[model samples]
Target: MNYMISIIIPVFNRKEYTRECLLSLGKQTDQRFKVVIVDDGSTDGTEDMLRQEFPEVEVLKGSGSLFWTAGVNMGIRHALKQGAQLIMTMNNDVVTDEHLIEKMYYWHEQKPEALLGALELDANTQQPIFGGERLNWLLNTIEEVLPTLPKDEQKGLHAVTHLPGRGLLIPRVVIEKIGLFDQDRFPHYIADYDYTHTARRAGFELYVNYDARLLTYPEESGERQIRSDKNFKNYYKHLFDLKGGGNLRDFTRFTLKNCPAPYIPFHLANGYTRRLFGYFLK
Candidate 1:
């Protein structure tokens, strides 16, 4: 049976980025999909812009509390209600090839029960930034594995442990089985890992389609440190900040949720403590 496709984007205030993302979607080789924007209290008149610019796209307003996870959940809920059999979640700061959806659909049709991801390349250098990832809890390291995969897999879809929410495709059955992202524990950060890991445990395969390519502004990602002075105060400040990459609270929660019971503490200490050392000692 043919499935209705929906691409869901969550935007806070980056209106220009959202505009560019929408434009790329419009130029897709396959226009057999709809767009949904979950605007979580964008003070930059994003709502007005969408109304004036792309009125055909649906906009859902939130009370500013919903961050990435909740916003995506909101979009998925709406999409499901609108008869969306397949849902794609993405970040706004991205542009795509004209055949991105077509390529993703082509790979997804081969194994419909799996979670599919689009290859994310850096917008400037055209180097792949994110394609697929393997989380090594023993070493507490996450490696970008798509480029190093077997050639056959490179030409096709590469199986993975988890896929980021950026340009991730979700079949309706996965949601029906595993439910939505755990927004309460992972509102803004680490939510994608949690969702995909959960889906993997629930018997869903994760694959990244290298042929489905999109350009993302890697420099515009979450902040890493407050300063280079190695000030202890700055380290502590950014460690728990929701928008920073060193979100210790969220990372700890993610480890506990995704890792095996015996490995949770080791993963946190071995991975984060070492990384924190770099932010301070280095």
Candidate 2:
């Protein structure tokens, strides 16, 4: 299918990473996609570098406040205006596989109505980290179940409750209907989760295409909110910070929206119990 697939990449000051990502995209066997990069408040000459090296990529500006969620939305909106048939949201910190587009296109052709995401691997180790994820209320954790599957078994589209924005592909129709990510509530972390959950509620099936894989830098991506080094005072202060990964308010809202109503209280308490305990004990 020679559809107009626009790849929307939200970037900050990571010109090198974005360059590598674009280079990888340039090498794809299926080069039928257009790349729209949202260079939000990049002071590191990222925009200039892109304009020079990757002249084909459409570079869009963002208000300095625009984080990952809003940044991606900027690109998505631009793509929509440009008459894209499919919109694939990506991060600048990843080097996509040569077959990423080809495989995603294949699965998309197979399931046009369903939302698709690429299986993400660690750039260095080549280990699958985020193939697909689901909110496991019983365990009070967001589980990456597809990556745990054996290599031979990870071939087709594995249904998932949520998908990361790393290489998430959505048909233009879905975005036209369901709308953009909730940056006001979840600016960065878990924004993709909330969007996917909303899409699921709106009668869209989400899946991870294992055959469509991309290599991403886990270290360079979002930071750990519950890290040992982060002091309790700072953690509490930023508990509701929009950019903080899986922060309290966003997590609560997501759980309320996605989890079973009966399990919500226990689910939230169970998850927060460890978080609160860890900080207090420390």
TM-score of each: 0.92, 0.91
The C-alpha local distance difference test score for the whole of candidate 2 amounts to 0.82
Q: Write the per-residue lDDT of candidate 1 for residues 1-282, one digit (tens) a residue.
A: 566689899999989999999999999998888899999999998899999999999999989998898999999999998889999999999998899999888888899889998888789998777778887777767788866766566656878899888889999999999998898998887888899999999999998888999898876876533644457676776576777567788888888888988788788787686657767654
Per-residue lDDT of model 2, residues 126-183, tens digit only: 9888778776667666777765788789888888888888889998778878899987
Q: What lDDT does each candidate get?
A: 0.85, 0.82
Backbone steric clashes in candidate 1, count: 0
Candidate 2 lowest-lDDT run of ten: 220-229
Per-residue error (Å), model 1, residue 232: 5.1
